[model samples]
Target: MGRGRQKAKHTKIARELKYDTYNVNYSALEKELGHPGDDQYVDKWADQYADDDEELETA
Candidate 1:
């Protein structure tokens, strides 16, 4: 497609998105926001490469 046509199509989509509103699920949002006792993340690769990381830091 021509550049002008592509630009006009983008402008139309942008205008529609700017004015449109949709329903929000507040309960899901709250759940995703945070929860206590949810800090169980573990990076096994970082742990495995601990010696290499220390060598880089010292250099």
Candidate 2:
């Protein structure tokens, strides 16, 4: 059985290139990087992950 929705795939490059949040379009990024359809595509990229621990600390 499938989860109904697709599980986003992240590329090593994207992971390294941290964004402000997890709401980015990895497919577009991949195209920009000249590696279209290379099995690393995310649907979101938000900035919340930037200061992960800091945000938690403040909270």
lDDT of 2 by residue, 1-59 (tens): 34333323345456656853567898888778774365776546654456578878988
Q: How much is the lDDT of residue 3 in candidate 1?
A: 98
Q: Tell me, what's the RMSD of every candidate?
A: 5.4, 19.9
Q: What is the lDDT of candidate 2?
A: 0.61
Clashing pairs in 1: none
* Model 1 misplaced stretches (Cα beyond 4 Å): 37-59
Q: Give the alpha-carbon lDDT of every model.
A: 0.83, 0.61
Least well predicted 10-residue stretch by lDDT in candidate 2: 1-10
Positional deviation of residue 24's Cα in model 2 after best superposition, in angstroms: 0.9
C-alpha TM-score for every candidate: 0.53, 0.22
